[model samples]
Target: MQLPATQAQLSPVAGDASNRRYFRLQLPLRTVIVVDAPPATEKNREFLAVDALLAQSGVRVPEVLAADQERGYLLLEDLGDALLLSRLNGINVDHYYGQALAILRQLAAADTAAVALPEYAAQLLAEELARFPQWFLQRLLGLDLDAGEQAMLAGLDAALIGSALAQPRVLVHRDFHSRNLMCLANDSLAVIDFQDAVLGPVTYDPVSLLRDCYIRWPRARVEQWALGHRDSLHAAGLLPAVDDSTFLHWFDWMGLQRHLKVLGTFARLSLRDGKTAYLADLPLVLEHILEVLQVYAGQDVQLDAFHDWFRQRLQPAIADQSWSGR
Candidate 1:
C-alpha cells in the first residue's frame, strides 16, 4: 500500500503498443513496475478489471500492489524484462512453447461465468476485418479494391466467419503472442497486455502464438505446434475429435483474420497515433498473412482471387524491406 522506500530509482521499460508507460522501480529488496496510464486517453480501470479476470482464470499475471484510479497509476509486481520473444531460438523454442501451451491449457478450463468479457461475435470479427481495407489498404498503402476484389473479400469473409464460429469457444488472450508473455524467475511465463481478452474461437490464441507478428517460425514447425495443441485440446475434452484437415482450416482462417486486424492496427498506429515503430513490424505480419493464404488459395476461387491480389499488391510493398522474409 506504501510507496517504495527512500533512494529507490525508476527506469523506463520498453513500452508495448499502447499509450501506457511502464517504469521499473529499483528498490533494496525487490523491483516492481509502475504503470502510468494518463486518465484522459487510456483505460486503466478496464485493465484492472481484466487483470482480475485473468488471475481468477489461473493465469500468472502481475499482482496489483497499489493503484490510483483518479491519478491513473498502479504499482505492479515486476515480471522482469525477459520477454518470451527474446528467449526463443532454435535450441530452446520447443521448451518455451511447451510451457506457453501448458498455460493455455489451464486457461481452457477457467471459469468464464465468473467475469464479464465481450464475445468475439461475427459482427465484431467482420468489423475488425474491415479495418484491413479501410485503414491498411486505402489509408496506408494508398490502394483501392476493385469490384471483383471486393466480391472476393466478401466470400473470404464468409469463409473466415464460418471457420471461426465452427471452432470451440474459450477465453482468448486476444494478443497471446511472445511479446506479451514474460519470463518469470521461477521459469514460468506471465501474461500481460490482456485488456482485450475475449470469448472466441479456440484456435485464435494458438494461432496468435505460433503465427506471431514480431517473430516467425517455419511452416512445418508451426503446423506441428498447432496440430499438437489441437490434440491436447481434444484429449482434454475441450474439443471433439475433429479431423486434422478440418482443424487446420479453422487455425489457418483464424490467423488470417487476426493478421488482417494486426495489419490495420499497425497502420493506424503509425498514421493516426504517430507511433511509427509499428510500421517496421508490418512486413512480418504481411508475410504471416501470405503464408496462410497460399495454403488455402487453391480450394476456393474467391480466396484465390484475394490471395492473388495480396501477392500482387501487398507483397511488392515489402518485397525489399530488410526484415521482409517471414
Candidate 2:
C-alpha cells in the first residue's frame, strides 16, 4: 500500500466478456489485481457485497484490498493465474471437482435474504431464454422462422422456465464454470467473477460447473457426480429427500435452460460485441443442448417437437457454418 506509483509496474491482463478490464500491479513487495469496472454498467456494489458474503461463508475469494465505489476501481489480492480449467484432466478431475463442489456447498449455506440477492424468478428466466431466439437463431444463424415455429419456441421456453422455478432455491454463482475458478498456490480453489450471484434453483450452480460450457464430460460420469452432490445437499438439510430421477430431471432441465441462454449469449458476443472467439465454443454448447433434447424426447411433447424442428431446420444451417466443426 505504501509503494510509490513510479516504482509499480502495471500490465494488462486478458478480460472476460464484460465491460470490466483487469491489470496486474506489481509492487516492490507484492502484486495486486487492479480492476476497472465502470460503475454505471458494472455491478461493483454487488461484487463487493457478494465477496464479503462468500468470504464470511468460508468460501475462497479474492480479498478486497481497497475499493473506490464511486470511481469503480478495486485493488484485490492476486489469486495467481492458475485457472481450474487448465488443471482438469482425466486423472485429477475427480479430486479437483470434489474441491470445487465443496465450495458450492459453502455457497449453498450463505444467507441469500441477508444480502437481498435477486431471485432467479420466471421473468428473468424467460428474458434469458428469449436471447436464443433473438441473438442465436436469428442474428447468428440467420434463421427465419414462421409463426408456427415462433409459437413452438415460445412453448419450449415456458417449459424450461417452469422447470427452473420448481426447484428448491439457493445462493447461485450464476457463472460457476471452470474459467471463473482459480487454483491458488496452496492448491485451494477460489471463486472469481461472482458479481452475478443470485438466489436461484439449487441445481443451477451445480449444472453450471458439472456441465460447463467450455468443457465436456461423459453423461454417465456427469450424472454420478450430480447425484453425489444431491446426496450431500440432502445430508446437509439443504435439499429435501427427492429420488434420483426427480433430481436429475431438475439438473438436466436446469442445464438445458442454461445452455440455451449460453447459445444466445455466445452469439451475441460474436455478432454484437465483436468477440468472435466465443463462436468456437458454440459447437460444444449445441452438443449439450441436443444431448438433453434427445434424453427428454418423447417424454415431453413440446421438447420433442422442438428437437424435431431443430434437427430438421436448424441442424442443416448449423452444419454449413465455419464454426460448426461438422
Candidate 3:
C-alpha cells in the first residue's frame, strides 16, 4: 500500500455477471486487482463482510488490501486468472473436482449464524423461479402462456420451492461454478464472487458445481460426484443419514431450480444489460433443465405436467433461437 501511485500501471480485466468493473494494477514487485463496484448497485459492504467471514473460516478468498465502501473501490490480492473452467478435462476432472468439493465442506462448516446471512427461504426461491417465466419465456422467447400453462408453471414452482425448503441449511456460495473458482499456481482452488452467499439448501452449491450452467458432465459422473459429496457432508455432520436416491433427488431438483433461474438471468443480461454473450450459454442450461425434468417425469403430477408443457410448447420456440443450435 506504500507504492508510488504514478509509477503503477493499470489495465482493464474481464469481469463477471455483475455491474462491477475490474482492473489489474501492476506495481514494482507484485500485481493487485482494483475493483470499481459502484455502491448504488453493488453489495460492497456484504462483499467485505463475507470476505472476512470466509477468510476466518479458512476459505481462500482474495485478500482485501484496502477498501472504500462509500466510494466503491477495493484493492485486493491478485489471484491469477486460471479459472477452473479452463483446467477441467476428462482425465483431470475427478482430481480437480475433489479439491473443489473439499472446499465446499469447509464452506458447509462456516458460521452462517455469525454473519447474519439471509436465508434462502421459500419466498426467495419462488421469486427466482418466477424469473424464468418473466424474462425467459415472456420477454426473451416471446411465449405467451395460456391460463393452463401458467397453472402448470405455478405448480412446478411450488414443487421446486418445497424441495429447496426441505434441505438442510448451510453457508451457500450461490455461484460456485468453475468460472468463479481460481486454480492458483499452487494447485489449490480459491473462491470468488461470493457476495451473494446465503444460508441456503445444502445441495445448492453442490448442484451449482456438478451441473454447472457453462459446462456439462455426463449424468452418471455428475450423480457420482453429487452422492460422494453427500457422504462427505454426512461425515462433516452437515447432513443427516439420507439415502442415495433421496440425496440425488435433492441434487437434481436443486439443479432444476438453478438452471431455470439462469435461463431467465442470461436472457435478462442480454436484453436489458446488453451482455448478449450470455445467450450462448442458454442451451446448456436448457439441457440441464430438460435432463432433470426427464429424471423426475411421472414421479410428480405437477412436474410431469410442466415437463410435457416445456417440451411440447417451449421447445418449438427455443429451437428457433440462433443460440439453440437446433
Candidate 4:
C-alpha cells in the first residue's frame, strides 16, 4: 500500500555513486529511508540479496521494512546519526575502526555455500585493468601505449593476476570504506552501499578500508590496523595458517588492482555521471597505484612502465585540477 501523504514527508537524504536518490522520510509513527532507484541502471535484486546476506551474517545493515522492486522503492530501518566519516572529525579513529573491523570479520565469515557470489577471476581483473588503456590512456590522457610497452604490460598484468588469484578467496564487501559505515545508537555500526558484495580475495576489503580514496590513513597506522584484522580473522577461524608478512603481500597486491580500477572508476564517475566531486580524489588514487607498484618492483617490470605513464599523464591533471580547484 502507498504510504499516506499525510503520514510522511520525504526529503533528500544524499546522492550516491550510482543514479539512485535516497530520501529521509518522516512518518507519523517512525522515520525511514526510501531508496529511489530508477529503472534504467540499477536493479533491485542485488540490494535484496545483499541485505539478506549481511543480516544472516549478523552485520548491522539497515533493516528492510518494505520493498517494491518493480517500482524501485524500499523503506529501510533508520541507522541514526553517525557515518564513520563524520565521526572521524572528533572521535577516536582507533575505536571507530575497531567496531568497523568487527563487522568486516563477520562478513568474511558468512557461509559461502548458500550464497556463492561471483569471484574476481583473472579474466575479470585483467579486463578491469585494461580500462587504463581505454579510458585513462586513450580518452583521458589522449595517448597510446607503444607496441613493446603494450606487450610488456600484458605480461606484467598476467603475473599480478597470478598473485591475486593465489590469495584465499572469501566474501568481500567490495566497497567497505569509512563512508559506507554509519555509527548508530549504542555504539553499533551499520553498513550501507553493500549491493556489490561478491566472493573475492580476503585482502580486497582491507585495501578498500585502508587505502580509501575519500579519506586516507597514514601508512603505518593502516598497516597496524590491517595486521590487527588479520589476527582477528585468524582467531575467528576464517583464515588458514597465514603469517602477517604473507597477508600483507595479499593486501598490497589487491590494493594495486583496486587502485587501478578506482582510477578509471572515479574518472568515469566524474566525466560520465556529471558528478565532479570524485575528481578531487583521483590524485590520491593514482598515488596509491604508484606506491604499490614500488612494493612490487622486483616481481613486475610492466607495473613500472604503468607507474611511469600514470605519472606523466595524471600528474598533469592533478596539478591542473588543483590550480583550478575543480
Candidate with top lDDT is 2
For residues 1-326, could you state the per-residue lDDT of candidate 2 as single tens digits? Answer: 55677887999988999989999999877889999999999999999999999999999999999999999999999999999999999999999999999999898888766697899999999999999999999998899889999999999988888888999988999999999999988888999999999999999999999999999999999999999999998899988998999999999999999999999999998898899999999999999999999999889988999999989999999999999997
RMSD in angstroms between candidate 1 and the native structure over all alpha carbons:
2.3
Candidate 2 local Cα displacement, residue 181, angstroms: 0.5
What range of 10 consecutive residues in model 3 has the weakest lDDT sum? Answer: 1-10
**Model 1 Cα lDDT, one tens digit per residue, 53-155:** 7788788999999899898998999988899998899888999899888888877877778678789999999999988888888888777778877888888
Q: Compose the digit string of candidate 4's lDDT tens values, residues 266-292.
A: 667766787778877776776677778
Candidate 3 regions exceeding 4 Å error are 1-5
Residue-level error in angstroms, candidate 2, position 323: 0.7
Per-model TM against the reference: 0.92, 0.98, 0.98, 0.91
Candidate 1 global CA lDDT score:
0.86
Report, for all candidates in order, the number of backbone clashes. 0, 0, 0, 0
Q: Where does model 4 exceed 4 Å of error?
A: 89-91, 312-326
User: 1-326, model 3: which lDDT tens digit per residue?
Assistant: 65677887999999999999999999888999999999999999899989999999898999999999999999999999899999999999999999999999999988766787898998899889889999999999998888988888888888888888998888998999999999999999999999999999999999999999888999999999998999998988988999998888889889999999999899999999999999999998989988988988789898889888887889999989999987
